[model samples]
Target: MNAPQTPGQSLLEVVDLAVDYQLKGISLPAIRDVSFDLRAGEAVALVGESGSGKTTTAMAVAGLLSPNAAVTAGGVRYRGRRLPIDDDDAMRPHRWNDLSVVFQGAMNALNPVQRVSKQIAEPCMLKLGMTRDEATARASELLELVGISAERGAAFPHELSGGMRQRVMIAMALACNPSVVIGDEPTTALDVITQAQILKLLTKLRRELNLALILITHDLSVVAESCDRVMIMYAGRVVEDGTVADIFNNPKHPYTKLLIDSIPDPSTGKRISRPIPGDPPTLQNPLSGCAFRSRCPSAMSICARDLPELGAHEQGRVACHLYPAPAEARGFHQMGEVTNIMALENLQVHFPGRGGMLSNLFGRPAAHVRAIDGVDLTVRRGEILAVVGESGSGKSTVGRVITKLVQPTGGKLVFDGKDMTSVEGLALRPYRHRVQMIFQDAYQALNPRHTIFDIVAEGVRSLHLVSGHEAIMQRVAKSLAAAGLNPPQDFFARFPHELSGGQRQRVVIAGALAVEPELIVADEPVSMLDVSIRAQILQVLIGLRTQRNMALLFITHDLPVAWSIADRIAVMYLGRIVEIGSADDITFNPKHPYTVALRDATPKVRPMINADPLPGLNGEVPSAARIPTGCRFHPRCPLAMDRCRQEEPPVVDVGPHHQSACWLASTSQHS
Candidate 1:
């Protein structure tokens, strides 16, 4: 086997790097013998699941490890010179001038009190020995270079949008004209369109400045779209390294294959996807052999006894017992049909905007924000209904309204043949127990001070569904086990803060299950989770839905996810259901222009060198306060006609159980 070679002189080389964190007197390995290189003007991506040490490796290279971490072995060299990264005083001079990092969550990284201009100028004043005025002027120029207006440099971080704030972070990273930049999950919480814009900007800047880039992220699509080379990490080890084409088209390692297959692609219709079973090994415990052997489908007896060295396989390098051996293809689960359990007819939820005192006194009514204006949808037992749309499309609002968290201004909500729109007190209590909600942000949803057992038991006890302490405990344990938190005793006493993001979400689901609800409304349940964990959570949801015959209302903005797990899909735009049909019909034969545009905007796993830019919508989502006249989506629709702008379109049946609200749907067949 051969080691990976660089085409040009190595700009940054990490040789046999190992790092450990000290807690009390115990040392825990966070990164182990990881080696990679970045060439001048090249972009490399580190891809892996959560706790895979991608961030730790980037931090080690950038000399930004926390206080308790120590570099036990190896070194990081820049341009043939080993850097004294551990020594702050020695590395200070070369920090921002030679290398800089755009940290995750730009809003949290920037100072709220200081203006953005000053924040970007700090590196110029300290490292370049520029006067304050000159540094400020340079900061303005940097802002302009990153696509932000120089006049907005005086604004605070809070005043900028999420995408703009990230651009500011990039401008700061390039403040001193650094030759290398490291971006850690730079597009973590951004929408698909904004994410495309950011990736485009990064690619343009890298080419113009000839800068070396290291991007650390769990999104494989992003890596495929923007990176030249790819490195797969797992349990603190670099399992595979190769060009994007080599890795994505023909992976060698089992873990690498699983990671690639786990991604749900809308371009392809409903490919079979299965989450990799089991959790990553805890770094605190030492293992004799491969850390991923327990989860590897192709694991052999020798895998548990001997550790495999990363060696050349095909055109890339891989570390696995079955390196050259082909992996077995896995089958997908098939969903069955069921009867409708809940239905919404002409749901309307409008909120009045604020009006001036003079207008209010004069008898003018405040304008209404049509959050969910006249939308019809349905959920079936043992079925997954995925409602997908961009931000401000009222996807989450529909979920909230279904859960009774927000009352509808005018609509009929039929659950179990009973109208729940005006139900209250005892009537509402029974309905609440029948329906449950799983929020997007698990950390915020779960009580920090409560134990896992108590959090799950709160609903059971409050509803008085069961009697006695032992009975409650039994129910809690059963629910926990159902949600995949096995050996409930181990997690019963743990707090929300002690669990990982995926674990916390499972806990939330367990709480919802404790009450034995027939319907579960999960709003963006796994958006913030890593790819592997996201797959696991989706599997859990599907498993529970089948085992218990419960209905799932999965609300998300990711179209591929909807295609992967949904029985039916409803694409929303400006408070209306623009399209509704089976997952296959919605993905493969989309009728509306809005749905087609969304499908095109989604990023898929492809080679970055010749990949085309996403044909994203032209303008931002129209505000609900003043939605566009006629078809609300006409402003951004590529196929919009004059009639679409002047007259609202009615729902037309395009196929069996398929409907689209577009003017052209009646006369033409769109992609």
Candidate 2:
């Protein structure tokens, strides 16, 4: 094995790498013609939506992918030597001290039965030839570097939060002080605050230790803040490669532009979303030309006839015909209206925390979290309503309350024609037929052991809407087709465990629609999906809503996603709706400082960060157990005035459908 770089030298180089899976009847490629470089002390981010071959590339780099998927062609050179990669004996020497990987899904990746300390120490002891005691001491030190305390070392993987488990992953990957580290979707399952901390720790470690890093993610913001260079992959191909600034400021491909436009912004009146329609092609029989041609807004005839090579355009490389050097694509500025639903008066919901069953026994939370406070909103028929906020901003809580999953503690909750704030038992059970909730993680809601037929049929059977197994099967087939799970016959026989993450999610959506819900409560439904797959799933939801004139209660953190489908928008902070209005006013004319900060934090290919410093929100949000005295967001609000500290602001009308809960917007406008 080679040693670390001496001063200035490239640490790793992968050239024209390709990986293919061989089967009895097919030879499918997973990664093709991928090339990138990383110098000592430098970082390169491999960015893409799910199924973009990013993971395949990482697997090749870390020597982890299954043998069935072989690196048939191309090169993975390290420190100028043809990699000792084929045999385990040749690869083991370089596995940890020279290179390592921080896998995504830390919770699942860690051994459930193992103690945190033991898990972290195993790799250190095995790879470094250190004794168990020595490795344990090093593991604690590594844990401290990534934000966890030494005390957590004794805890089991199940005892830790998602963020804590991820930190353990980072600690273990760094236990042997590997020179090159690759992290895949490192923050996918964590909350916004925890994600920030993980990113900060990764950033600090990279700079201070000069370790070469490869961050694999679907998030553009992570790339903007952490990496100097980036590679964008799509359907087993490297579509673009360049410096972070070059790619963001001069995105040359149509797919790249759409990917960037799909993020949501949270700053004024009402925000709109324009999610791309259609799913990516199956890898089994890939199309001849550009893989993105089917849904590309600027696609030309040339794209259908030829596989547009990842040719160069401007400073970076782009793999689309439209970017033949004079590419111009419009994005993120398009938004969609309420034709029917309205929420009247205001709604409030509070939940208790860590209280005994007796506290819940008393008909209240002994200690609680005020999730939705005095929120009045509407969702018109044929329209999409988006609710935006960072995690713990009461966004998901709002969805739960609307779906009647949680009873509101106060105020009116009038739906189509009924007061729903206090509904219970039979009334609520029937409402489940009309209003359904889509959870963030499909796996959480899906029964992994059951076949697709049983999963989707659960809701159908509960309602007792169908007669025999034959009739239930008919309804299941129809629902599956509606969610784009074609060949419903084949899919029904497949279990959730046998399907991909995206496919499992489609099954969940199919289950939701089986009940024939008129109003769907989508709580970060697409957050766990890959960027490209997310757009497809969203488009399906939108199509269903348009056809059925259904109302949507969308909750998410991404602003571009909201702009694509949301008819109107609502921004929540802490437990209250800070602002509500039309998509246009909110996306373009944001008044509240908190809204401005939230929007500014959003990362885009061409970020709106030309002149002003990208706003930095400070201080952790107060724990729900003890919220701030005044404005919940005041501690981090850059525009907080003296009045903001002593008193809370009331909602003020800004436009025909826009209102903001900011004292500044109220005082000047009213006067």
CA-lDDT, candidates in order: 0.85, 0.77
Model 2 stretches with alpha carbons more than 4 Å out:
1-344, 353-368, 609-614
TM-score, prediction 2: 0.49
Number of backbone clashes in candidate 1: 0
Score candidate 1 by lDDT.
0.85
lDDT tens digits, residues 1-671, model 1? 11233446577878667788988755678887677888877999999999999999999888889999988766788877888878777877767888899988998999999999999999899888899999999999999999999999999999999999999999999988877899999998898888888999999998887888999998788978799999999999889999999998998889999998888876777477768899998877645468899999999986775556676667877888786322210011122223478999999999988777987899888789999999998887656899999999999999988999999999888898888888767768888789999999999999999999999999999899999998898889878977878778789999999999999999999999999999999999999999988977887786676446578999999988888778789999999999999887787678888888777777877432222333567789988988999889989876788998999999999998899999999665444
Write model 2 residue lDDT over 363-428, tens digit each, in one string: 764657777766777766545789998877888877877777777888777777678778888767
Which consecutive 10 residues in model 1 have the weakest lDDT in total? 327-336
Q: List TM-scores for all candidates, in order.
A: 0.50, 0.49
- Among the numbered candidates, top TM-score falls to 1
Q: Give the TM-score of candidate 1.
A: 0.50
Kindly give the number of clashing pairs for every candidate: 0, 27
Model 2 C-alpha lDDT versus the unseen true structure: 0.77
